[model samples]
Target: MILFLGTKSGKEETKLLAGISCPYCKQTNTLSAITSPTYFHLFWISLFKVSTNHFVECSHCKRAYYKNEFTPEMRQALGID
Candidate 1:
């Protein structure tokens, strides 16, 4: 028998960034911060978290920004350190 083992993405939590504006949309208070975790899985069951990802998106333009792409202002606003 063969067992399946891999990593899978977990639930994402979203928070509205009240003071942040979307770079693409240029709309204030339209940015939302999304956070999710990647888990190691065995036989389709999640074992442990491997990593966490952070992203920012615009509610109006639907633009997404990755962690690495986040600006200092964005990082400070999101409390990401």
Candidate 2:
């Protein structure tokens, strides 16, 4: 018997931030935050979530910000500790 295994990313959810400006575009209320949960799978069945990815995008500039690049202001806007 053969088995298949891999990691898959789940659906992403977006949340708009208020009273926040994109550092790249300097636009207000254009920051959309999204998070993806990566799951370990076996035979196409998700076994458990390995990690979650956090990111923010600027609508105007189309720039992507990852967790490592997240600023204090951005973290506050996303309500992330």
Predicted candidate 1 versus true structure: per-residue lDDT over 1-81, tens digit per residue: 999999999999998888777777789998889999999999999999999999998889889999999978799987888
Task: Give me the runs in candidate 1 sitting further than 4 Å from their true place.
Answer: none
Q: Candidate 2's C-alpha lDDT?
A: 0.90
> In order, what is each prediction's RMSD in angstroms?
1.6, 1.3
lDDT of 2 at 72: 93
Candidate 2's residue-wise lDDT over 44-65, tens digit each? 9999999999999998899999
Candidate that would win on TM-score: 2
Model 2: worst 10 consecutive residues (lDDT sum)? 17-26
